[model samples]
Target: MDQPTRQRRGLLIVLSSPSGAGKSTIARMLLESDKDVTMSVSATTRPKRPGEVDDLDYHFVDDAGFDAMIDEGDFVEWAPVFGYRYGTPKAPVKDALREGRDILFDIDWQGTQQLEAAMGEDLVSIFILPPSMNELEHRLRSRGTDSDEVIADRMSRAASEISHWPEYEYVLVNRDMDQCVAQVRAIVAAERLKRTRRIGLVTFVRDLIGPAH
Candidate 1:
């Protein structure tokens, strides 16, 4: 007999890493390859830049609107960055979860912690680390977009960020980008198949046995 289809709950996949550690690249590849996952659009208080769509690029709101959301508990997690507030809105995320669609988050360790506190069971947090601090600095220098002073600052912050690797459910050393991406894909596959997430399994099994059993 053909097997019954199983419906699973969606996952909140979080990728956190220091600058130049390759988390962003991995996230891009995952989204490109997986139709079920999409990047999380953050609500921001920053003014919309030229050519940026309000809801597609970000949910742009004024300071008062953002403050109202915070007061009303409409955000899963939020933080101020360079004088502007950015946050994951709760409604879209909840809708995605109910529809069994995965959402990818590219945030820092602190935001990951807040998300975990809000939705621990649904979160699959991963931290990416460079193979070595020296390699990390090399990657930053190779970008050629920063001054020496900025590179030094990033290196300093990288140390602090790397210290939080223990907080994540998975930690990957990005020695090889392809290999790392494969590992992340594997993690997503396994997490999707977990028994707790497979909400339709009980019914599937019951239907398999039939009424005569």
Candidate 2:
């Protein structure tokens, strides 16, 4: 087989950080490098920017559609942010898990909490932080995309977000982008080796013990 053929144990891998903290970048790099893993496409009421495609960057929806999905209990996790609502749809992620593929989530801490509540042990959560406040501010300012007002708002929120670091299973300080990617990759690799996540290994191990010996 080209890849692991046994049934894929579904995993809900979450990477949460405040805006400009590089969670999205790390998530994308992980998806690009791992064949068995994929990004969870989120449903959103936020308007798509130029060159964004449906079911790629997001499953763009209107407020009514989003409400309908919520009413139907179709979201694993969802939240409103900056005047728009975004959510992870339940069905596709469930299907992906059944296929032995892992799903990656780049969302906020609140969404992480909801996902953990919905899926429990299947979720692997990581919290990423900037090396320092100065570095964080530098990253936010370097973009030159946010206005002074928006940047201040993001910084204010970052403080509260960082306060929740202890809530995650892992904490990664993204001082160097490459190092941060490596750290996240290591976390995924370690999680995949977890005994509970590899139930199939039990049978294989028992076989090695032999029937009569």
Candidate 3:
């Protein structure tokens, strides 16, 4: 008979980049193509934007609700961004890792630090960089989603975010979208094969070698 499939622990994959550096695009492509991974929906105290579905986009909650969750120690990591609070609920992340299902996080450096402190070896972080600062500014303008003032603010924030690139396990220069996505996928594939993640590897290898006789 064929042997049962070996179980493995999941990864907490973090993708962080400066605004308009293509991490969001890469993340969407990955989620569409990768079946073993899923996005981690965060709980936020901010109001949902138009067409944003609750629990799908974000679990919107009031300040009081967020405070309650904090008091109960329900979050694995939480942070404040733009005067709003966002947190990764502890229960779902814990469950996913135990089930050998990966979770993706699209957050900034501060949030990544919190997760790294909480998850250590279970986390694999990637920082995406723009080819050039000029090119980064160009992409922000091309999006047409923000005013010049807002774009300038984002550019300043981008510099700060890029300074933290050394914190990640992998760094990719996103000169080409398709190539970057491919490289990130390769990272995921390799990380999944890590000995620590493969919880059943020892037994599987033992079975292959046959009982010590």
Candidate 4:
């Protein structure tokens, strides 16, 4: 007989890293390889740009609409950036969680902290690090897009970001891109199998054992 499928609650996967640490590359690889995982679409007050679709590209709203959401406690985390407000809406996240669909967040430590506070049990936080400071600088320089001044600024900020590594549930050193991505995938797999996240396990085990007197 075919075994019954085990339902599980979805995961909120957060990936954080300093510039040149390969976090974005790892996130893109995971999304491309795993159909079940989707990127978190943030709601923003910024005006829609050319060719952007509503609710797909972003849940674009005006200042009053955004404020209403904030007043109604609709956002998990919100912040002002360059005169525009951006936030992760609670409704879609709750819906995804109930439907057992994973959401990926590419956010910084502060945002991760807010998410952890709001959804700690369902959240899996990972911090990616460069193999070394020298290697990080080399990677930045090799990009060939940034000026020497910009590279120095990034290197300075990288130190501050790396200091928050201890706050994450898992820390990975991006010595090789493929290895780092594999490690992240492994982490997601293990987290999905956690007993707390797997729903209906008690009944499944009980059925296997049969009814007791």
Q: Between the candidate structures 2 and 3, which one is better when assessed by TM-score?
A: 3
lDDT, candidate 4, 1-213, per-residue tens: 213335899999999999888888899999999999999988999989899999987899999999999999999988765468888999989999999999999877877888999999999999999999999999999989999998998898889889999999999999999999899999999999898988867667778778791
Model 1 off-target regions past 4 Å? 1-4, 46-52, 210-213
TM-score of each: 0.90, 0.93, 0.95, 0.86
* Ranked candidates (TM-score, high to low): 3, 2, 1, 4
Q: Candidate 1 residues 1-213, lDDT tens each?
A: 333345888999999999999998999999999999999999999999899999998999999999999999999999876478899999989999988899999888878989999999999999999999999999999999999999999899999989999999999999999999999999999999998998887778778888676
RMSD list, candidates in order: 2.2, 2.2, 1.5, 2.7
Output the TM-score of candidate 4. 0.86
Positional deviation of residue 62's Cα in model 2 after best superposition, in angstroms: 0.7
Off-target runs (Cα >4 Å) in candidate 3 are 1-6, 211-213
Residue 190 shift from truth in candidate 3, angstroms: 0.3
The residue-by-residue lDDT of candidate 3 on 82-106, one tens digit each, is 6899999999999999999999998
Q: What is the Cα-based TM-score of model 2?
A: 0.93
Clashes of 2: 1
Task: Look at candidate 2 and tell me the lDDT of residue 82.
Answer: 86
Task: Give the lowest summed-lDDT range of ten residues in model 4.
Answer: 1-10
Candidate 4, residue 21: how far the Cα is off, in Å: 1.1
